[model samples]
Target: MRKQLTQFMFSILLLGRAVAALTPEAAENVPFYHIPSTIKYADREIERLNKNIQTKPRLEDSIQFKAFGFHSDYLPVLSEIPDQPRWTLDLTFETYTGIEELFLVPTMERRIGRNYNKNAPYGFPSHFRVSQVFPDGRIQPVYEHNGKPHLSRMPLFIAFPEPRSSSVRLEIFKGAVEENREFFALEEIYATSFSYIRRAQSVKVSSAIESPPFWGLNYLFDQQTNLGQPLGPKNPSLSPKQQKDFSANFGHTPPGCAEIEIDFGENRPFGWLILYPALWPEGILIPGYGFPGKISGTIIPENQDGLRGSSSEIENWTGGSPGNNPVRLHGKGHIGRWLKLKLSDFPQHNGDYIFAMGEIRMYGNGRLYPVSGIRLEGFPKTEFADHMFDGYVGGQPVLFFKDWFFKTINGNTARYEKQKWEYTRQALEQRLDTLLRSTAMSIAVTTVISLGISITVIRKNRRKKIIELRRQISSDLHDDVGALLGCSMLAARHLEETLSNETDILKVRRIIDSTTKAIQAMRDIVWVSSDNQDSARQLAEKLEETLEIYSGKYEVSCKHDHLLNLADYRLQFSEKRDLLLFIKEALHNIDKHANATRINLQITVKQNRLKIIITDDGCGFDFRQAPGQTTGQGLISMRERANHMRGIFTIKTSPGNGTEITLELPVKKKPSPLKPRETTNESN
Candidate 1:
């Protein structure tokens, strides 16, 4: 119990520090920095904090510490002409494909060595434009980025609008400038839709430096980034004993030239082949450890030994450290039932030069061929040769290109968010330290006392506010639902007395309508209290559904464009509830007072402000006497709701003229006094 109290006090101290750090000047600079936008980001931070609390193998304390291990034999692509007029990369697809966004990885690593470079290379374009090219050679601009210079080493994500085209074009207005020379350089580019990355069938570049082994055009579509392979933060590094046991369970390779043959039972076309390198035993990842210095592949007929017949060399790779980045080789148009891989010049581990590989994969017809459970053979009955095709590396499944890209990009983004939070935390700490040093001993004591008193008062006030909120919600529920339900019951009782008349049928419809309104009122009240429904799109959807309930009585015309922008923005709970209620009340007023035939509701979003206009062609009331009119309470309620959301509400109406109601609201509301999810003692 005492330990629990001590921990609670420590937490309180941290809370005090945070509260003190958030001064008026400091608060303006941080926009919702305390709130996490995604669950993955929050999980990452929690895991990191847990690891920090518990001591383990201490890796480098840097952003790259959690990055995937990667290496490539070639450099990033660059423009051939340093001062070229315009550098263009055109991607032609085999069929028409829709591209919603483009993801570009800059040339961060100038060269692949023992470790990947963290800095981006020179000559990255400052501004660029992406367009769609038709088969008739007409180009339409789809997206453009003309913001500040692209200097960050991170990947650039550009969103495309209205994308459905046969081909795409990426053009640079001005190439990157360095030392009075201008050139465009990029490590990789990907056109992605909502679900998957769209791989272009062919690529065309206006000018590219196609130097072999260092720089080439292939680097642009290599699917390799400097961010390396996606790896977990707590990936285990086996101890010497563990390694020994693992080797005993999943045998290791013996020294010498090793050849493995895979028979497909029938002739099949293979376009891509991947060779996954062995995992580093010590966790100090040397990418291509124990991988052969020289590798060769050959294709042969089925059911025949590769050694007994003449085989054609399909692919060859020499001298490359393929860390977590698997060696992917293309064998386009190669049709064979049997594949033979010859590996030589093996790297030495301990005292022997041994050849070890995690897995081998072959792909054709845009799908991975099932290699698991397929019997493999070795030329000389190589020890542990079958273990190489187990579809796993260090007990973990080998990741595909798209899966790896997704994980690596998400990991990099999470790291970036972590770095931002860390910077903000450090700034807060520094300000806190300054504040502490500037305060005298008496002032510090008085401040602590005042803080304690303030905390107590705040708690009491918070409880009172919660109770008041519950009371407000309770009163609204009573007025909206209870009154309607009561009217529904009274109408039902009235229906029995006039059972044979047409008036009874009309009375039955009124009762059904009243009951539905009561149910809808209850549903709205429940929706308003829900914590999850916060997005503007959800609010708009709810509003549309509410408006649809009145479709039978009046002709409803609703227009809401810019849904994408609304989808991206979020609204506080109070703002969402109030705005929804305000619109519903306006529609309700039109139904009750005005004999309207046609109703029009148009909602537009501009400059972070949401405008709602509702008009009806009906006998309208006098705007001057609206407050004293029969429908005065509904108007007052709508105005109060709008005012609560910090919005502007106006009604323009005159006798025999149509009524127009306009509401202008900022999408984002100021911080409310009440916190989220706080439970009150009052019950419904």
Candidate 2:
């Protein structure tokens, strides 16, 4: 039995050691006597307690107690579990090494799930209560509900008080619960202590809080001395009256307490402040008196939603309807930081408290800022033409003035300026072209008419000349040749009748022969003069006969060859005339001057030129030297006639030699339609 008891004691010791080892340091620090949950009693017992209590039964008596025992098997309660707390309390002792005074104020977030549990016996609480304990075994209760206390609820608590702390033991508590529980839960506990001391001091509350349009005021605390006015002294440059005005415009005065100081800091160029009067919430504006000052820091306007008007007159400040109130101004000097207020030129009446100032921001350096103004003028459309006219009129500035003047003054203008220059020039050119053509046509017509008239006149004159030549030839033939023939016939007749003796008869025969020669000469002359084919042929036959009559005086021969008919010769009168003249000259030359014992004469007519050759063994004279000695006029006359008929004449002769004369004269002949018999005559 003794061994069994010892074993049991050993097991108990081992169990205690395990429990001690398992407990955390934070859990050990907590006071063991604190209630973990509500304790409940029987109903009859609560009634008895109520009769034994004071005038009203305190609901605290109905409280029931439940022991919260440690069990490894049970799940840990949330209050028994450790957590990070919101409030921390601290205390410090000056005389001792330990703590002296401590206090804690916790920040509460009314979270539904964390502050209360629906699983608790009670419903949602109308108020919350908590108790704090100190190391000296003292306790205090604090209550709060909906950010206030129960006495603040009047009949419930005597007083709703603020927490207090001094240099002593400290305690901290909270009012909370699990979100699912119907009752509130307490999660954190804190305790501390420190030493305490007493002293006299001055405190200053800040005047930073003010009505709209008033700002830039700060609070100061001074423990040195007690004085009624917190702000020391005003700057000497500002008179009392000016100070009053400044305060009135700003809507708040500096705080009056010793230990508190008001600092306007630095007054920058082009910066101003604005205030709104208490009576006029919308009547807030920058004061005109501070227009040229600089801004120290940022200035925010009050009732900024009331701001209105064009942006032209305002610099550095946003101007619009005052939806987002308070325009902000920033920076240091005149150019970008200044604000100008045109309050003196305000359009509306200034009466009562209708005027208020908000903020004034000034912009420094006028060159960097822009100012705007408005102007009204009528826009003229017709006046633009007047400007052009002024430029172009006399004594005015004009482009290409010389060219314009030359054209305008000389009655010449550009094509576009003239009415119908193109049409008129084209018409004039066409008219000139037409006139030239007409003149050319007239010249051609006149030339043709004049040529026709001249041709007609020439033809008529040629016909007349031909007729006159025919008439002259006819008269010569009749008068000269006819008379000669008659004389010849009379001489032959007279010679035959008057002769009787033999010598005389022979002389008569010689006279008859001479008459016969004269008759032939007359016939030849007539034939040449007549220019007819029958006359030409008759003359040829008669010459042959006459040459035969000379056969006794000399060995004379005559040959005639006719290549053309008599009718063909008549049609060529000019050729007939030329041929006749050539023949006559040949015969006359032989008869008078040949002095030859033998002679031969040949005549041929072919195509045009007539050829005649006369050859004689005669006493030939030097033709070059004897032109004057010999009767050579017949040869000259034959050449002249041959030239007239476009023929050739030639003579060949030498002293103690025969003479040959060749005459070729052109004959214009027409071939006979009927063939004529060829005739060749040879006479000796």
Candidate 3:
């Protein structure tokens, strides 16, 4: 229990350090330092972390450090066997020693792949951290070197640490939010084992026998051929060089069996065997030689000969057509000094029969063995055998082959972590995508609804203005022009009957003058409502001119004040119509009713509102009595028109006081359709 807590704390410290040092600038230095010789298998793996920290890596996989804080722990990172649980990463440092750093880099060592992991360029030298912990729970120097080598092989299976007097604890830390800091993670420092060096030794092969298609033996068990050295280029034809170096034969002559035999110096235990089929061009097996249709492999005692023990297999092997064929050795395999593989009853080729092979390899005693002696029998002397045994005994075994196996395991392990990460990320992004789609859809719906409302309002307002204009025009023709036309008709009839009455002629002339005046008045109304006269400046000038013409009938003086840039402020057709008509009515009242003389008009606009004030210094009438006693539109038409326009109108007048009228209207409101009044303009 105490050990678990210590390891937990160590994990926390290292993670904290990782978070702080996760800056892009700092990640460049991580994973570049060297590790002790007791750790490296053949080359340096620490330097594999590139200096490009431009994109931080991300790793989200589960890991545990069971053997990290203490010794006497045994667990593998992973077991290649499927039934076993995946190994967790663990590490240990020398107790009471110094602090160290570990860099975690994320890389899929391949090309710009069209596949999943290959395209993920994220998670490079992803994470970094410094560790300083001692076995006694004491602090150590910050940047110490010469720390014990804690990792030798790539971790694949769960493994425990060997016992020690004092064990080291790594500092605990957490990851950082900085993106560049996310490339990779070092879950724990492993307490590397040196015992593998002592327990592992070289295996010596005694001889090779009748592994006919002699060149095929070299293809399979060439000891000089190490990791990364695959079979040389294949050929369908035996070139002079191909015959000299690679070609081999395996068909039996007629009587004797065809097979290959390998001998170890003494009795040994066996675990597995592998055979690599020599490939011709396009991966076809060579034409003259094919795999044995019936073969038996047995482990016999070193002193005894013949198949005298329980054999693992004695049957026809198939599916040896393309690549390698590997079989696990079973039964009491310890008695064998020779692993004998016998082939007979070859299947017919072009005309004859043969069983050909490329290379053979065996694994036992915890190490890959080298073939010491090779013996080929039961064949004509003309067939040639290259020095196949020499290749088997030339190179170092563990460093050459096992290294490849372990590295492959590591790559597979990384792939496992990657698959899990992708699944989680994809699920989260899908939910986010759904939310964004919903928001966009809602916004679009709202915009469409608002547009519908706006169009309706515009059409309705236009209809209202049309109705109002027609009523005003109808009233003008009815009250003024109709009366004149009637009077003229009467005068013409009277003159026609009498022929020469002076009184009748004068009456006809008066009628003609009245008709002309009424027509001009109607024209003036039409002109006021015209679009061309929409500007305030134009309205003001026209108003002054109307006042001048009306006041011409009296000694009254009319003055108009000009508002600056008021013309720039345009008025709608309805606003101009109503404003000009109201002014005209007031002027008409002063002309025929108000007995006094001075009139002043001021027009101004501010903040999109137009204000017009008309003041008359004349004998005024009562405001209250004007509504009932007055004729024509009186106060009703003015008030109704003002309300329809969404403006305010006021009249200040009394028996002895001058009258003042004011109207304020908004420039943007569409004119409301106001109902016409029944009354007409009689007098003020």
Candidate 4:
């Protein structure tokens, strides 16, 4: 029996494949029919009678019939049908052309009464009715008027028995004008048997209902096969095989109808199932099959009407009412079970066909689990205590204070460091100023002290020089005068002794004359020193007198000239003394040392210089050797006097030649005051 059933199912599947192979245009125009064995006799009798009593012959080309049958109990377990003394027959017919004008030849069987094992009338009945099956799997009735069938726009038909019964039989036929035969194509048919059974009030809900992942599915509505093909001529009816083939081609298994099994393990606690029905196909908006239902789990209708025949106990399982309806299943026992979905009714309302599933949740015993491992919709809120505790006991305040203090201290330190640098710079500048001042004061003090010392030393040196000059002058005067006196005495003594002889008397007279002149010249020198006359002029007068006195001894004569105005001459007293000494020395040298016949003394003054020239016609010595050979005191005194007066003295002489002494002393208009000094003793 199982093998036979399997073969039958295989045959049905093969028929669907054959229908799919037809060309789209042919399939669109073709009509299909389903004939059951119970209805076959009625249809065949009509065909046979029409063949025998042919008038304007009914053409086989006008229509064709194909047949298929199922034992009707093959799907008994699935359909929940009961076994009884019952039989059922299903029929379908299709018309290609003249669909409005076509009619089914009803059989003589009346629908009012039932009799077991009794045959009904065999001829076509006068009353004909037409119906259609809609795409949503709805069967809608059509009215019969004046023995003619009125077809509804729907594509499904439903005919109920006069009295409710477990079994039913139906016959169907098709008729169209012969002329429209060429426009007719017959394609397929479909049939189904429904058996009545007492339904149990207690409903069983599955433990788990699994849904497929909701990615990449397109939604559609009223989806028919070969929709693009042109509608061809209609046919009146379809055979059983034709209906099966047509349904196999045009009918579609609804999305989500695939049975899915879910296991939540054993002995799970009761929980609430929150299904997101929004994930279903948009076709859920349809009126019948697509609507939510309570048969599989727990359903809350989105529409108010619920399901069709909602008052009937059997239809109470259909779920749509209206408005904001939601489907929720409670109890955790439903976690593991297999669920089968029905989709045939979805096309009645919404046109879309996409299938989807939103987040599903299960709440049980203070625990929640997601239907597909999805989490709750929103993030969980944190507790206030957690935040408060985190803020405390972390030493965050100390860290913050340290950071702030460090920054503050760093800034202050930087500022103070800058100030310190500036202070150091200021101190250095002050020190530099102090050092410069100290150096300048030291230099000034040292310079002043040095200048004072230098002045004192210079003055003392000048005083010593003045005393030396006075001594030198006195010594020079004494020596010259003493020497002249000695010569005068000797001459006088010789004259007295030689008075009796004539030749000696002349020599003695000459000697006595020289001595008297010498005494007079020395008196003149003394007179000039006391008189305070210009030293140069006085010295010139004395020199002339000395030379005259020396003339008796050596034939000497002195001449003096004063060219400078006496009042205008500015010689210092020391300089006058020096000039007098220089001239005296020259005259003395002529008297004592020059053994010559005559001497000449000349004094000349010009500009700031006084020149004294003494020439002697005497035996002169070599001047270079004279200073070394003789006591050069006179020469040394003359040179010293000249140097004291800032003058120049020169001697010109040679052996056997006359000697000349030149003294050139510069005279200044405003001579410096002579330095006073105590006289030092000098040997004559």
Best by TM-score: 1
Q: What does candidate 1's lDDT look like per residue over 390-502, in tens digits?
A: 55565455564444444444444334444444555555555555555666766988899999999999998996787568667766777776777777768676775668778
Once fitted onto the true fold, the runs of candidate 2 whose alpha carbons sit more than 4 angstroms away are 1-495, 498-522, 534-562, 565-579, 603-610, 619-647, 654-657, 665-684
Candidate 4 vs. true structure, TM-score: 0.26
1-684: candidate 2 lDDT, tens digit per residue: 234335435544644553453233423333323212101122233344333222111111111111111001111124432333222222222222232222221212222765543222221223333333344655565443442331110012111122433222112122234453222212111122211111112212111122222111111110110110011122345433322221122112221111101112222233222211111222233222222122123222222354322222223332221211222243323322222232211112233111222221123322112222111121111112122112211111222211222222222112111223233333444455566788899999999999999999999898678767866865775677667757766876687688677788787778777767676666555555454434345546656765776787789787777633423543355655556656656666777877778889887777754567889998888957776854457767777877887767777788889788887765555544777667767631
TM-score of 1: 0.44
Worst 10 contiguous positions by lDDT, candidate 3: 64-73
Ordering by lDDT: 1, 3, 4, 2
**lDDT: which candidate is best?**
1
lDDT of 4 by residue, 399-445 (tens): 11112222222333333333333443344445556667998999999
